[model samples]
Target: MENAFLNSLVVGAVLLGCAVFSALAGDPDALFDFIVPPGVMPANVSANNFTFRATKADFVAGKLIVQKISLAELPTLDGAGVSMATLMFPPSVADPVHFHQRASELLQVTSGSLFVSFIDSLGRRFDQKLFAGDAFLFPKGMLHYQINLDPKKPAHAVAVFGSSNPGIVLLGPTLFGSGLNVEVLHQSFNISKETIEKLVAANTPHPL
Candidate 1:
């Protein structure tokens, strides 16, 4: 009886440790095996299996299309701890400057070419030109943008994230369209109020 009690205590300690680690790492998938207690599969496992297909409705007319899969869409992926999306950029189109707060992204170009640029934490800029079958990595929380290089052909790429939910923030919309005080933006950007107003106005009706 004493041995059993000590073993139970050990197991409890291990579980507590795992819980703490999962919280710190932001990886709930790490606790999947322990939480599910073995032999019991999650209900959504079968239902969530799917194939991703991109169509006209998936894109924003002439710009880009992103088809994403995440934990919110498929709970079964909780064990996988990763999410992905496919991006389609029409010729001469560009994705706005953006960043992912919760995860880093790896983009693999499947067809055509892409011109990608990013700014590091120190405000240093890096640019790369990717061709078919090329890949690039964008560090988490860094500002980045992508432009389709081919004016006659569309480009296709797959982006994988380290976290289930990779939060995205578009720089222009978040800054100009977020309804923050116009004076603050003017001061922060070192631009005149008229310039700020024009920028805000341009970003209001249509966000790039």
Candidate 2:
């Protein structure tokens, strides 16, 4: 009778081991002992800045709508460290010549026409005209800009950055608006005060 009991115990242990292995090997989603809780909602740890478009005539006829989205307020994943925003430029408008000092970026065009050009410190040059489904990568600290070449339509694109909060150091706003006075800017860019005022005034109201 004792041997019989020992045999029964051995069989029960074997069954338990098989069950454990089966559970582990099966679909990962079904591995939870009880129905797992749903995913958590994204948290807003910081307040996002708001800026209005510089021009109201963007929708009228011959103006541009440039939307700036800052990546700093976006949520971060555990292993991946990045955030992004879509920038839209209306027809015939141009993004200011700029550079991302710290973060590299991948810009993928989704609609309309886009013209991008590259310029090096030594005056070397290269450029490409992208349509609805083209993508390009701009390395960190390299200067670049996107222009809407379409004569009658708008252009849209998404920019993916390598950092969670890819800060934008806007060239015009940073250099011309606050840092240097009108006299300095006039000397640097070889433009008149009227032109400077018009350009500065065209800038969308941004966070201070």
Give the alpha carbon lDDT tens digit for every residue of 83-201 in model 1: 89888999889888999888888999999999998999899999999999999999889999999978789999999998877778888878888787998998898989999988888
Poorest 10 consecutive residues by lDDT, candidate 2: 44-53
Best candidate, TM-score-wise? 1
- TM-score each candidate: 0.75, 0.57
Per-residue lDDT tens digits of candidate 2, residues 68-179? Answer: 4343332222223354667677778887777776567788899987998766777776688998889988766677888998777888888887654455566666765564
Regions of model 1 farther than 4 Å from truth: 1-28, 34-61, 204-208
Error of 1 at 30 (Å): 3.0
Alpha-carbon local distance difference test for all models: 0.80, 0.65
Estimate candidate 1's RMSD in Å: 9.0
Q: After superposition, how far is residue 134 of candidate 2 from its true place, in Å?
A: 1.2
Model 1: lDDT equals 0.80
